[model samples]
Target: MTTMTTRTVAYPADGLTMVGHLALPAGTDRRPAVLLGPEGMGLSDVERRRADALAELGYVALAFDLHGGRYLSDPEEMLARCVPLLSDPDRMRGIGHAALDVLRAEPRTDPDRIAAVGYGTGGAIGLELGRDGVNLRAIGTVNATITGRPGEAARIRCPVWAGVGSEDPIMSPAQRNAFTAEMQAAGVDWRLTVYGGALHAFHHPPVDHPTVPGVGHHPQHARRAWRDVVDLLAECLPVTEDQSEVQGRLLTEPR
Candidate 1:
């Protein structure tokens, strides 16, 4: 296994003291980076683990917080906070930019080679960042089929990949069509993957707490979505060849 360093970083965004998880790959040489966003419930162990996994793959990853260090398990609380936030493009951009700033400040991060991958509300924020004209290498979102303001998508300068569950009620067929239309009209390099028979947040792991209706975990699809996200990163913001070899050797080394 490729050993990595992980830490909690506190920063301010949208009047909240956001606490994000930062993961750094082994070695000091600069590497490509990813801005990771959690689901509507906020930053949890799942997202932090994802950041660590990205680091193990030789990328600096920052899993950003949504609720100022709080992880909401209550569906009502999550909806109350996320519904309005998702509607405001400016707010989403602010959060994304704040996390981007944090990621760029890392000494090991390559500012020119960065991608944004988010889930649920986090995915919407990543799209907002792209629409705000942020220079991202790629944007990958899951379960966030949201359309931006008129002509704003034209500002996106990188490829975008979106994943959704075919049966997701929150991201209805109409919403997906609108989102695709916006991207197509803007001339973006975009694609969408629908996990058949899955419901909303299917990419997420099973949680002990109660969730909203239509939200359920699909392990098979979740793994596939993760692989797809990794593929997108590999295509758009690959790590150096030497780093790949190092990671390969680490994985093969005996204990």
Candidate 2:
């Protein structure tokens, strides 16, 4: 397999130091980019690997941080930080914009051709970015069905794909309905997929630390959800010709 270069990037967000994981494709040419957001636990290896995988597929991917590089193992701490942050649209947009600026500043990123994908709390942040009227190519989210504030959803300018486990208590049926309703009311191009028999955080790998109730991993669903996200990106932000050449040279099928 061709080696994709990866790096740790530090930036500022909400008066705190934010660390992001950046992955670049093998070649030096500019390419489409993605802003990856992690779950409430923060930017773990899972998000890093996801960025690497996207880079391998010929895009500049940056796994943006949430808690200034801190991983919240304690459920209470995670909720304490995430609940308020999620509730405040300005805070979410600040975090997203900070990381997005870092990704856009990368020489290899084609800022005009970028997507945002996130999981759990990160997913909510991605949605907030869209609601803030950032011109993203696409938005893909998992395990998050949070609705935006009144009249804010209309600001989203890109297609959105959201996935949630059918059994995710955190994203209940009512929440899903509200999210979809907002999208529909705004006339945004959006789609939702509910993976059957899966629970909250189903798109994540098995956790080594104790997780709160309703959080579990389904390996099969995780991979499928990733494919769904990839499909969204392919539809909205197709790779450039140079990227296709590099991907072909790597002997891997196009993502």
Candidate 3:
């Protein structure tokens, strides 16, 4: 594991206090920075682990909190907070932009190497950033709801890797098929990974609670999905040097 650093960033914009964790790869003068958005439930321990993993791989990972330090148990309450941001593209943009600014400003991060990755509603936020021209090199979305996303999807010039479960009820086969076709037509360098036999929240295995009001977890997909994240980031946002280890490794992976 690389030497990692974690910090909580409180941004004055939108009166939201977002907690962020930065992890750096060993011997890296300035590493790529990634803005990671948490699921609708808020920032969980699993996300923290993901940040640590990203840091280990040599990127400054910022696991952003959308709930502003408050978490809700009921799904309705969670929706209340998340729905607004999803409904209004402007609000989500502000949050994502602020977090991106924080990540880019870090002295240990390279400004040109910034990416955004998100899960669930956060996935929509990542897409919003792509549409707003966040100037990101890449994007990764896990179990995302792609409603109202077609318009913006076409505007995303950056490469996108979106992962959804085969059994995801929220985003049915029809939706997925349509989205895939749309991205293809839009001329966006896009890739979709569908985890077979996986359901919503398929990446959170250690999290299990009946009243949690969220999807069940799957460990296998979690591991595979994270591997994809590392692989994609290395491909999309490489360092300035001409050397390309990341590209070489990605070429080895089966497309």
Top lDDT prediction, candidate number: 1
In the predicted model 1, the residue pairs found to clash are none
Residue-wise lDDT of candidate 2 within 1-255, one digit each (tens)?
A: 667999999999978899899999998889999999999999999999999999998899999999988999888999999999989999999999999999999999988889999999899999999999999999999988999899999999999999999999999999999999999999999999999989999988887788889988888998899999987877778787664455456556557
* Candidate 3 lDDT tens digits, 70-185: 55556778878877777788888888888788888888888887898998877778878888877889989997747445466677879989998888887788888887777787
lDDT of 1 by residue, 185-224 (tens): 9999999999999999998889999999999999999999
The per-model lDDT (C-alpha) reads 0.95, 0.92, 0.77
Rank order by lDDT, top first?
Answer: 1, 2, 3
**Per-model TM-score versus the true fold:** 0.94, 0.93, 0.88
Residue 2 error, candidate 2, Å: 6.5
Prediction 3 global C-alpha lDDT: 0.77
Off by over 4 Å in 1: 241-255
Off-target runs (Cα >4 Å) in candidate 2 are 241-255
Report the number of clashing residue pairs per model: 0, 0, 0
Query: Which stretches of model 3 miss by more than 4 angstroms?
Result: 145-150, 208-214, 239-246, 249-255
Lowest-scoring 10 consecutive residues by lDDT in candidate 2?
A: 243-252
Instruction: Please give me the total number of clashing residue pairs in predicted model 3.
Output: 0
Pairs clashing within candidate 3: none
Judge candidate 2 at residue 84 and give its lDDT.
94
